[model samples]
Target chain A: MTAPAGQRGRGRPRDPRTDQAILAAALELFTEHGHAGTSIEQIARRAGVGKLTVYRRWGSKDELIAAAVESARGEIPSPGIGDLDGMSYAQISQVIAEALPGSARTLAEPGYRAMLAQVFGSSVTHPGLMAAFWNDHILPRRRTAHLALSRAVDEGVLPPETDIEALIDMTVGAVVYRLLRPEPPDADELLAYLRSVYEQAGMIPRR
Target chain B: MTAPAGQRGRGRPRDPRTDQAILAAALELFTEHGHAGTSIEQIARRAGVGKLTVYRRWGSKDELIAAAVESARGEIPSPGIGDLDGMSYAQISQVIAEALPGSARTLAEPGYRAMLAQVFGSSVTHPGLMAAFWNDHILPRRRTAHLALSRAVDEGVLPPETDIEALIDMTVGAVVYRLLRPEPPDADELLAYLRSVYEQAGMIPRR
Candidate 1:
């Protein structure tokens, strides 16, 4: 289905930079105006590209918005479990201390917060999008963390019968609840709170 | 600045029934269309009242919407701490089993879920609304739960140094995360998970 050589030469090939520009514009506008309020035309104009180009690249506004959200999330660091085997309580405490603050910082980003709100709100009406997000973004991260926690449990770092799924829920849920607050706690305060959680769970020895 | 007796009689006192009708209509509309999508006229028409009456009563759509949300929440039974004093592991387990399910049920309602989505999404743009909700609804509930947890700690039902606030966050956040999922666990499964959490924390002894 390649175009004739002459036709291909007359029209310049699609520029890779256009994709980045469109995604950037889409993210900004989506955060500012929300999904319903934003239009493809505005995204194109903001990106300094033609509407047809946007349509050609992404068939619908929903597709473009999804890509923008994915782009905004970027890369989530996969926490490794190699050093977790037979880790001492102090070592486990250090791991929690280092991990939680990074999570808090990422969730505290204004754009990410806005995007999450939109995703959750829209999920009710659009279960498909929610499914996709869970499959693509949430499930992978949970799997990685689950593996690490399982290793920790196997090595007796956590209690033998530890409910890893619920533990993950509590840890992740607490961070999310803080982000949803009108004035989320500062990173230092959040880190202190995480420390308190670790201490209560007996992951860190009392002073 | 009382109105003259004659003027008051001519105007006829505002009907209390109208208030009920408006609230009912508002809750239905807000749940179906969300805050941004719903309008005063639709609510007035649905309630069989004049637009002027709706405006005069509520002053603004946001006020009306807030009232609707409040009414929908009905009453949340404050989990009492009196019986918690000297409570056994089995008794504490029973209390959690009763409490968490009720909270989960309220959160699982379609109307309530819609309202939560709207609140979370709009909170980014409307911090004032978020603050008011926090002050009026969230703060009171948290305070009640906080009091109960503090009492539990004092009674030795929970560890002496338990981070009561973080515990609350973890409990509430887990239920919320479950609700947000595409296919949340059933009541029995959720209760089992919650029991596991309590057991792992040594709040309840293992069977």
Candidate 2:
């Protein structure tokens, strides 16, 4: 209920570009210092904005983190027709080949580790953080794998009684567990072998 | 080595009590602040010891952190059953129920998550941390589960044709994935259901 007209205050207006910039900076901060260690002042400084601007835009550090992570998604390769699901398990080995090089580098980066620590660690203490990390990252990737498996199941490549949930968890979870290893098994080779097992268990002829 | 050893160079000799106090302080600090956030000054202050005293004894923060964790290694549980050849799946489920509460909580802790991030993340870069983490933590816990499954197979409780590793992994791995959730399921209930599914797969009998 503003009686005064044209009372808006600002220089160059509120650019969504600036918001995106701030979010990007926040992601960088989280990746560097983690959620607990990061501060609004750092995000603002990195974004070339004022601390007041950060506080005004996002009420708390948690909100800022959510916004930052929400952007910069689509970086992860979704499990779809491309290399993961489109081809037969044997053919899908190529996708793993493509990913390993980057996986090696990305996992090595301190920023990446810090980011993972911030998310996986804080998830237990903060439900909101857990929701953000899962919905934003895990669900999309999980859906991709789920779709691939669903296709495999529909094709009768898996036994009608195949434990779909178990099958998915074994392959995916094992990969994550192995990611903690120095020398992980080749994803494609493992996938190729796993698919063979899946087919054999289902009584399907393996190529 | 003919030296003037008149008074051993300083005021109070190194007290075992002080050493224990320092270690305890380090543990409390590490648990509260995580590995990366904790510092030597904080540890010394918490212990009510001089900074020089702590530095002289522990040497480095990493060394101190390692000592603090190693001291608590005795607390991690293990299924004491030497062989499970005669035990039913209920026996196996019982073992999990007894051991999993602490296991779940350990994996859920922020400090442990920080440690995990350091190991897993550095594994891509340093390679040594991976071997250490596996040899120290993951492999040992995993061995108990593996031994139980293998024994079940040997005793004819489980089908001989079972992919023992895969089956065991899939079952426990799913539970672990669920355990990492903010609102974790009841460990007993989950283990019971997993055993039932194993029975359906003929890995274990219905009874």
Candidate 3:
């Protein structure tokens, strides 16, 4: 094998492509077979890489899963702080309204829901996976949501004494609960459902 | 082994204690190891019953899990319609307030959360389990919730145009989402959290 320049190690240089392949494999196997059910050997085999190749990058299965989850951070709609900053109330409202359809579509995806199920299901057994998801994915979105709610209060859209955390919890929790139910709504129904929840939470004005 | 009095073309008569033992074993195994990871032999061994006893009661794994889930219904709070039917608005409010502490304690239990996680985690892989949960557990609570919200609207506790279904979704979802978080609140914090959510939703007045 021709060695690429800039490689100081004894083996091949770290390739982004291989990293992606390995992470993807880890996510798929974990999603399908769960945390305990999957192993480094299975992931390496699935990625078509040597076990040493996986071990070199990730010392343990948990570490690899945490990285995979971190990489999959924003599969659901999470409007970042950058996206909301400096936008007028009307502009912010319009952006969220426009985003709802696509967000609903994503929520309706089987793969995404399965991934969430796996994270939750494994939370008690493998706390690291949930911890990774919370730190990397949920915390950022929560901060952005806090910013958005603070802006709403400042703009006099919501009552001054509004419980921002509770509102956010209800809104997000409602959507997730709806998704996890048997015969979850299709994309169109989910869009409508999301709108209703927002309206109920007073996040969006009633239509 | 002596056959009991109700034997009709059967080796041994049905025993309530045997049923309880088998169901308990099934629930425990499923909660710990999940659906695909557990089997009849394991459940039988745990319950100290013959595998044939399990087969005689539930023809398949899915059926056993379904029955176990059905038996475990109402592990969480679900104030029934009958509980609310004759109560004054004030009485209903007091009952709910009194129930909140116990409900919070149940919600904060690790066993309950672990059971919930297993159900959700197995949802994609085992739709039957979720279906049984929905029909046996969630639907009755939904009906009761609808009645309670309706009573509130009728008694002028909520606005006339309140969307009952959306409100219920948000309330139930918020609690579930809170519980599923990495660092779930303790009983006291969960009690406060529940109060905050209800207050925010106008289900209960601000303290």
Candidate 4:
């Protein structure tokens, strides 16, 4: 096997800065115009990179779309699983309020919402891409949250028999639904609702 | 002003059966192919009627889409507000299971799911159509459920302070989230989850 092109001292060296530009461009175009509306040429032009550069880096439009989505996912902050062990209820709520609403704000953007709609809409026709998205992006994040929740249960912060997976699903799912609606709930309103839900669940005592 | 064609009836009379055929065809095509993919011509052809018939009845594709979605909405059974008073926990649980899972099953269909995604995805670009959909379809259904839930609160089946709107939003949103996923939860599983959530919320007591 040949050394990867970036490692070889042949031709021009691959610039990390150019990769960031391309990824950002890809994400913007994909979100704004959707999969069918976006083109690799448009992404290249937006990034001020050669068409060959994008192709060489991503292989195909599908791969580029996946990369852009993955990049977006990375930008969102998630709670540290390690922090769950010693965290108090207020601290956990703070983590959720910060992490979830920030992501909701991102999701509420017209372009980003369009991108998600495109992916979900096309999943029936493109099962492989959907599977990759689930395995690589959705599942890992879910597992992280799940593990943290399980720890909360073990520590008696949540009841022993609480269905952590369903709890996570319901909480996240409600936020997503609000984001997808024509009129999303205000961030403060959503935070308050979540606080009430957690309090009612006995995850935290009512204030 | 000239009398409408249906009433003028110079040559042929308007048949009610033909109206049903057009409505059914519109719903099918709109669900399967989405708003942009479907056309009046295609709908007419599918219904074995002339294109003029569709235009005469619905005026435009947007109106036709609204009519089709409205028709589908009418077909889904909702709990009457009258039924909520004095309903027992087990009775309420049964009502929720039947009403929710049935709607979920319909929403889970690839065709129906595509229709919803198309409407939601295009909301940014086509606010008029989206507004009409929300006004004519979403709002009415929500109102029905809201009235029923308000009765539940009044009857002491649910807490006096229950946030009926938020409760409705979270419950429906969770189901919508599950239905929209590539691998939706099983029907029975979702029903059980809903039951548990209701029980935990004190809308119903544990079995």
Best by DockQ: 3
Best by TM-score: 3
- Model 2 agreement with the true structure over B1-207: per-residue lDDT tens digits: 122233223456778899889988887776555566788889999999877787777656766766765554555565654654466666775675556566555555555544444444334434553565456555665666666667677777655766666555455445444544456545455555455444434444445
Runs with alpha carbons beyond 4 Å of true place in candidate 3:
A1-12, B1-12, B74-77, B86-88
* Candidate 2 stretches greater than 4 Å from native: A1-14, A79-114, A125-127, A147-163, A166-172, A181-207, B1-21, B80-133, B148-177, B185-207
- Tens-digit per-residue lDDT, B4-51, candidate 1: 222223244778899889989997886676667779899999999987
lDDT of 3 by residue, B45-160 (tens): 99999877778777788989889877777666667778788776666666666778888998788877777788888888887888998788778767766766777888997888
Candidate 4 TM-score, true structure as reference: 0.75
Count of clashing pairs, candidate 4: 0
Candidate 4 lDDT tens digits, A1-207: 132334333355678898899989988876665566678899999999987788667667787777777776665566665766566555665565556566555655566666665565445544444555566557755755665566667667666766666666665555555655666545566566655554443334456
DockQ score of each predicted structure, in the order shown: 0.45, 0.24, 0.67, 0.29
Q: Write the per-residue lDDT of candidate 3 for residues A1-207, one digit (tens) a residue.
A: 122222224365789999999999999988888887899899999999987788777767899999987877666676777888998766676667777887888878777778777887887778888899889867876676677677788899777989999999998889878888878788899999999998777666678
Docking class of 3: medium
lDDT (C-alpha, whole model) for all candidates: 0.67, 0.58, 0.81, 0.64
Candidate 2 C-alpha lDDT tens digits along A72-94: 45455443544454566334434
Model 2 residue pairs with clashes: none
Ranking by DockQ: 3, 1, 4, 2
Q: Report clash pairs, candidate 3.
A: none
Model 1 residue B78 CA deviation in Å: 4.3
Q: Interface RMSDs of all predictions?
A: 2.2, 4.8, 1.2, 3.1
